[model samples]
Target: MRLNESTIVSASPKLIWDYIADPGNALHYMSGVTRWEVVSERRSGLGARYRMLIQVGSAEVGGLIEVVEFSPERDMAWSSVTGVDQRGRWRLRGVGGSRTRVEFRFAYGVAGAGITGYISELVAAPSLRRHLRRSLQLLKRQVEHERLRRDAAARQATPEATTA
Candidate 1:
């Protein structure tokens, strides 16, 4: 099954890309993801691999996934290397000042499970869509909050120039 969702975040594309492209920040925004750990020495960007598991029904499903495409602050795509057959991509575009349009796409299917896999996909489609939407919402909240925090810190760091 294929699922796509998008949201606008009040943060620059670079900020959104930096946060989403880094697997270390997945737990902060990815809903239903129970495990997201780097399995390869290379941490972020192209060729990076991670062992991930997402809650599905009463079980967790996933495997090692490798980054198949990386376009700096624009796009990041990955596919499963082992375990469940899946592909995912994140696309970010700057929309006006300090606004980013972020889209997440995911596709998954069983390789040899045949009918059972189809049935599972049918059953899990709704939940998966819901999770994807929730994840985006969480991501938007996180990025905006971080932006606010950073802006506040910058303001605090800059002392007012006293008039002579």
Candidate 2:
């Protein structure tokens, strides 16, 4: 099955990229994700590997996933190495004025399981879609909050603020 979701976040693409590129922040913003640990030497770029798991229905499903595509603040894609067959991508497009249209695409299926796999994919779609939507919302909130904090700090350090 394949799923795509998008959201417009009130933050720069660089900020969103910085937050999502860090594996350590997955559990903080990603809904249904319980584990996202760095399992390789590199942490935040192409070839980086992570042990990840997401709660789906009654079970946690995921495994070692490696970053197959990394385009800095633009896009990142990953493919499963072991566990559920899946490919996921994050696409960031600047929509002007410090805003970004963030897109998340995920495709997964159980190979060789025939009709059972098809049924399972259909069954899991709603929950996975919900998780994706909620995850984007959380990410937007977190990144926007960080943006606000940085803006406030910059304002505080300005010459005008200091003189006033």
Per-residue accuracy of model 2 over 119-155 as CA lDDT, tens digit each:
9999999999999999999999999999999988998
Which lDDT values do the candidates have, in the order given? Answer: 0.92, 0.95
Question: How far does residue 85 in candidate 2 sit from its true spot (Å)?
Answer: 0.3
Counted clashes in each candidate structure: 0, 0
Encode model 1's per-residue lDDT on 1-164: one tens digit a residue: 89999999999998888898878899889999999999888998889999999998988999999999999989999999999899999999998988999999999998889899999999998999999999999999999999999988877777463222
Q: Residue 69's C-alpha lDDT in candidate 1?
A: 97
Worst 10 residues of 2 by lDDT: 155-164
- Model 1: residues with Cα > 4 Å off, grouped in runs: 161-164
